[model samples]
Target chain A: MSNLAGWGHYPIVATECLPERGPVDIAGLVSAHPSMIARGHGRAYGDAAIGQPFTLPTLGLNRLRSFDAATGLLRVEAGVSIAEVLATFVPRGYFLAVVPGTKFVTVGGAIAADVHGKNHHRDGGFADSVEAFRLVTPGAETVTCSRTVNKELFAATTGGMGLTGVIVEATLRLRAIETGWLKQQTHIAADLDAAIAALEATAASTYSVAWIDCLARGNALGRSLIYAAEHASAQEFELLSNGRTAFPPARSARLAPPLVAPSWLLNRASVGAFNALYFGRGVARAGAPELVHWDTYFFPLDAIGHWNRIYGRRGFVQHQCVIPLETARGVLAEILDRVARRGSVSFLAVLKQLGPSHGLMSFPMRGYTLAMDFPMTDTLLPFLDEIDALVADAGGRLYLAKDARQSRATFEAGYPGLAAFRELRCHTGADRHFASHLSARLGI
Target chain B: MSDQKTVLILGGSSDIGYATALRYAEGGWRVWLAARDLASAQRNADDVTARSGQPVTVHALDVLQSEKFVDFVAQMPALPDTVISVIGELGDQKRAETDSSYAAMIMRTNFEAPSQLLDIFAGRFQARGTGTIVGVSSVAGDRGRGSNYFYGAAKAGFSQYLSGLRNRMSLAGKVRVVTVKPGFVRTRMTAHLKLPASLTVTPDRVASDIYGAAEENGREVIYVAKRFWLVMTIICLLPEPLFKRLKL
Candidate 1:
């Protein structure tokens, strides 16, 4: 037995973690353990990937089964990470149709969370790019799920929090690109309303995201820097690379912080000062349309390895929710105000626009999503409850991938499809075999 | 096709074996991965081929079955340019001291089986007049201690065999033998132990060191982290009276 935690490092649990090096015998494992949950890279920021007694880590099952160059379709084992895919195919002029903020996450985790990216408004969630997947069911039978085969399972498994089964392999559609570069345009928004307007205006771009200053108050409340980008063509890349048209070479991380930061080091004042400098730098370079590598444009935080250590040993919780478009602007402003009033320091805050959801329990919808990270501290859990009530009233739903604590009532209120999902689980006998901390907490 | 190099890894399912296969594949060599578990070897072979865009084949070879060694060599598609044996078992020392069967299994896994397999490859290489052989040994072989002398003794015997092979191959002036002594590698075999972080290195580090040694001629023996050489030198030269008195 060993202690394990999600990426947030909060709610650490002591469990028997089975690391497999070959094709997993899911049926055997399920029959042997009282209860278990399948985990991939443990990238989910909360309890969604942890179990009470058993956690099956699929990092060892990584392998690429096949690839079709003519059709740009690739089949890979669930343990294959987005970073691995990028490393192998980027120079070959292909990219994943959807990629989350970090490339460190595995394909299985992305499918389980139905992760969305900066291109969500244009490309939809990860389910849009997935064509099929092989799942080892609770009954120990391997079944292929897709639009035409095991259709119901396909709908429920994506974004089902790994309750449906253990995903083993997936076939994904890859987007062809001329070069691994993006032409990015930055827009500086002085306040909450301006930020929303900028995101709405650039809805046509292939990718768009905003970095907000959560501590800024009054007239500067919700001040943000919005980045809109499109894939750079070969000619555009050549113009920037001294007539060279080759893809960007992979580079190692520049910095890896210590294992843990001192508890007293990340208070409100220190975080506020860092935000001020970051916002100022963004404002200074707001106008020019620059050609930047994909790594710099999409995964800026990845450059600092183990960045979660900045939140200290107690770890942190990320509060991410999406409100309907009709009430997004008002709800966003209220959320920013409530956070500022509480004087809780959130070091990183992100805002993005999403298109319609693809899976039964997918997080994305036609609305605006806001994500903020708060270091674990006394008086923070109750404060988050207040925010949860506000979101429920606005008919908004919290992202399970980022949730560590939330009332069962709040979860049911947001997901109207919960009853259908539960019914399927009961029919498949998944309710008795597959489980996680998040599943138990939400009474799924 | 003639210009492409080929390598055969004997324990391809092991962490160090898989990593070395990937390193050689990245260097544009066709890799043959052999393991007792055919399923695991195939998976690793597919992964190496996918990641490096190089061809990889899988074969089954159970080192414990000494009688099958001849047939296993004959079945290979061709004699590879290099053959690396990374097969060993770190059996429980306490159990081995009391159980003769367990102690004998450890001895055969670490010393006898590997030596027999390498002897076959060495004979073929000698006849071919040009080949490289790498044997992965452990730093524990430098000295025996009360904590794990069973595994250490087997490894020490294996290291001696490799040194003798190197001496014999040098006279031929065609075949090369390299011995690798890894101090503390963070692999599944050592996952249960709480090793000091400063002394432990990743399997990838050992894989690259092996690749570098095979590519450069006349590089006979090396330590994975290089620092282990100095550390082992002191341990090997220590006075036996004082060494036996201190607990490792």
Candidate 2:
């Protein structure tokens, strides 16, 4: 047994770590271990991937099976990382129709979490692009699942946190692109109203996201900078003589911390200074348009490897939630007001607009979602609990992929389809054979 | 002509061998997996085919059954471009000290079976003028220790056999032979022990290192984790008087 933790690195658990490089190994592991969950790149922010006694790591099973150029369909193993897909197809004028903030996650994890990206308002969640997948059940059976076939299992497995079965492989539809660059436009919002107005103004863009200054007070409260982008077309790349045939853009080398830093390094004083500089820079660059690499525009934080270490050895909690569009402004204002009153400093605060929800347990709704990261502290849990109550009252639910702490009542109340989801789990025999710490904690 | 290649793994069900087989299959090689249990090997073959979109063939070959060696070679669909020998047994040192049969089993499994199989292929490759052989030895052969010296002795014998094979094959034809020594690999064989985190490596690292060495001709021996070469050099250089008193 080895000690393992999720991306957040909080509440470390001791479990038998099985490194599976193939479906046969996964089948053997599932049969050997009663309570086990499939882990891919360990990117889910909490205990969702950490079972009670077993964590079957799928990293070694990574392989690209096949690709249909005419249809833009790709068949890849469950452990294949998004970074691998991008490296193989980005230069060939293809891209993942939906991408999360990080490229380090695996296909299995993306489906299990049903993660949404900055383009959620237009592209939906990760499960939307998946055509079909193979699931290895605890009984050592490989079942093919798709929207039309094994409909209940398909619904339960998506956003099911690997409870339904171990994802073996998946076939996905890739979107064609003219180039590997994004044509980006930026706008500055002075306050909460201006920020929402900016989002509304650029709602038609294929991709839109905002960096909010969560600690801003009074008139500057909820100040943000919204970035909206579209895939660069041939005319947008007119600088290159060959237009659409221009060379693919190269990503800059990544940077990483040499070692873990002292826990006291990222306190309120330091974060406050950084936020001020960011806000000032945003104001100065209002309405600025630039052409950036797809990697830069979609995965900004990926430039710094193991950037989570900057949060210190104690790790950090990422709080992400979505509220109904009707109550978005009021709910967000209340949440920000509480954070300012508590003097909590979040160095990373982001906001995005979500489209209609698809997966049964998917986090998104027709609303606005905001995410923030705060270093774990004594008062952080209570503060988050308070925010959760506010979100639940507004009919908003917390994102399972990014949650490390949330009460059962809060989760159950937020997701109205929990009963149907439970029935599916029971029908699939997942309730007894597969379980994780998060599932046990929430009575799932 | 198509740029196609084929590789045969002697102990394909082993963790290290299976990982290496996956690497070869992913690189567009038709992999033939030979092991004691044909059913289990077929399952792994199916998995590799699914992952790589390449065909994989499974064969039954118990290393102890030397009498059937010639039949196994004759049944091959085509002469493999490369054949990897990843056969070994870590018999209990304590048991080996008491029973001669235990020690014999360890020696036969690690040294005799691999050497006999390679010798057969060596003759065919010498006549054909093209082939490669990868012998997976171990760093335990660098110096004798009370803990697992029997297993080490077998690997040391295999390493010497590979050295002789490389010399003769180089003089006769283009046939190449490479020996691999991996230290503290995380596999089912070492699952029961508590190993230091910094010193242990995954099977994938071993697979890539083997692939890299085979890609370049004239390479003789490869330390899976390259740092192991230096570590072994220091151990091998230690004075006999000082080394004999210490427990590893």
Candidate 3:
């Protein structure tokens, strides 16, 4: 057994990991290990993919099955990562319809989490682009699930957190683009009211996201800089350029922390200072339209490889929650206030607007979602519990994909569809065969 | 048109051979995996076909059967543009020291069989006027060692044959030959040995080096890790008296 952790690298768990090489291997593993969970890239940030005795790792099964240039439909193994997809297809005038903040996430993990991106408000979650998928169930049967076939299984498996089955292969409908660049505009908001106003003002943009200064207090509380963008069309490039433009060549990560940083280096003072400088820089770039590469605009954190090491050996927790649009500003302001009051500084704080949730356990709602990362400490669990209570009161759900320490009561209160999900799981016999640390802890 | 490149891999059941097959397949080359065990080669061919989305076929060919070698070449559907011979046996040193037959078998497996096969291909490739040949030798062949001198001697003979082939192929201008010398590699052959992680390289590394050598025109010899060239050079420079006195 080896110790494996999620992208957060927090709460490391010891489990026997099965390295699955292909579809046959995945089916064999499911039959051999009664208790197992399929882990894809381990980007879920918590215990959802962690299981005892067996964590089926799908990295080895990555392969491109087929592609139709005309329809833009691509079939790939579940283990193929977003990074690989972007590298292979972007230059060919295609892009993933939905992409999470990190490109390192595998297609299966993204589906399991039903991950959202900046364009979620416009294009919906990752599952919206998936046409069909092949899943290996607990009984070692490979079944095809899609909207037309096995509709209920389709809903349950997507955002099911690997509880229903192991996703072996998936077919995705890719979006065609003129170029791999975005025409971006930034808006600086001084306080909670201005941030809400900014989000409302830029609702027309196809892609929009906000970087909040979580430590800002008093009049400056909930200060944020919003980024709004859309793909640069060929006509726009023609008008702007001399008719000689080429797609931006994808750049690989060139920098990575060779070793873990000292924990004390990420304390309140240092993080606060960095937040100030970042906000100031964003404000300086406000109102100017800049053409930026999609990789740089969508996945800024990816430029620095092994960035989790910056949080030190103890790792960190990312608490993300979405509240109704009406109470979004008030709930987010209070959440930030509580985090500031606790002096638990977060190095990265992001706020994004989400459209309607697609699956039974999809994290998004037609509202605002705020995600923040805080280094692990003795006071973190209690602080999170308080935040969870406030979110529950506001009728918001804590994202299961990002939860490491959520209580069973909190989970029950958050997901109203839990009963239906459980019924489906029971009907499919997943309750008896499939289980994860999060499932067992939440009493699902 | 670029996807029409064909590469034939002998001893395709070996870890290094399978890795090379996958590498070539990924490069848009149709691959033929020829090994003694048809089942194992077919499995590897299937893996490459899946991973690279390229065509791969398996054929049965036992290198020990010299009489069948001619028929093996005749039976192939089409001659490959490039051929890679990755056949070797790391025979038991202790057994070789005690039994002369074991030493002869070691020489036969590592040297005679592969060179005889290559001797046939060398003529066909020269006549075709456009082909690349890669033979994987070993760094142990640089200088004789008491531990595995029989294996070393066989590899040394193989390397000498490669050097002559490289010279002959270079004169033809269209044909090229490359000799690959890999350091300590962590394959099934050395799985039981407690090899230092720092010193032991993976089969993937060796495969990439071989692929790289073929990519460049008229590239003669490749030390898998470039640093091995320097190490082997220094070891060869040591006086015979000093080298014989020290145990390697």
Residues B1-248 of candidate 2: C-alpha lDDT, one tens digit per residue: 46798899998878887788889987888899999967556656765775566788888899988998988888988788899988878888999999999898998899999999988888888888999999999999888888998899989999999999999998888999999998889886886778777777898888877887886545679887777888889999999999998898
Candidate 1 residue pairs that clash: none
Error of 2 at A264 (Å): 3.2
Clash pairs for candidate 2: none
Shift of residue A163 alpha carbon in model 2, Å: 3.3
Clashes of 3: 0
Over 4 Å off, model 2: A1-5, A12-22, A25-38, A52-80, A84-94, A136-142, A176-180, A231-254, A258-260, A279-291, A427-429, B3-62, B88-105, B187-212, B237-244
Each model's RMSD to truth, in Å?
2.5, 4.0, 4.4
Cα lDDT tens digits, model 1, A1-444, are 888888898878777887564456665776676577888878789899987577988886577877777888888999889998998889888989999989999999899999999999999999889999999888888899999999999999999988888888999999999999998999999999999999999899999999999998899999999999988998877776665446886556899886798878887899989998998888888898888788888888889999999889999999999998999998999999999988888978999999888688888889999999999998889999999988999999999999999999999999888999999999998898789989998999
Highest DockQ: give the candidate number.
1
* Superior by DockQ: candidate 2 or candidate 3: 3
Share of native C-alpha contacts between chains A and B (below 8 angstroms) recovered by candidate 3: 0.10
- Candidate DockQ scores, in order: 0.50, 0.17, 0.20
User: Candidate order by DockQ, highest to lowest?
Assistant: 1, 3, 2
Give a tens-digit lDDT track for model 2, residues A1-444: 788888888867788876555655788778888888888889888888987777888885666666777898888889989887887788778899899999999999999999888889988899999999999976778899999999878887888889888998999999998878888888988898888988988889999998998889888889899999988886786753343444364465479877776788886788899998987876776665667788888888888888888888878899999999999999999998888777777888898899986778888899999899988888889989999999999999998888878999999999887999898878767787788888888888
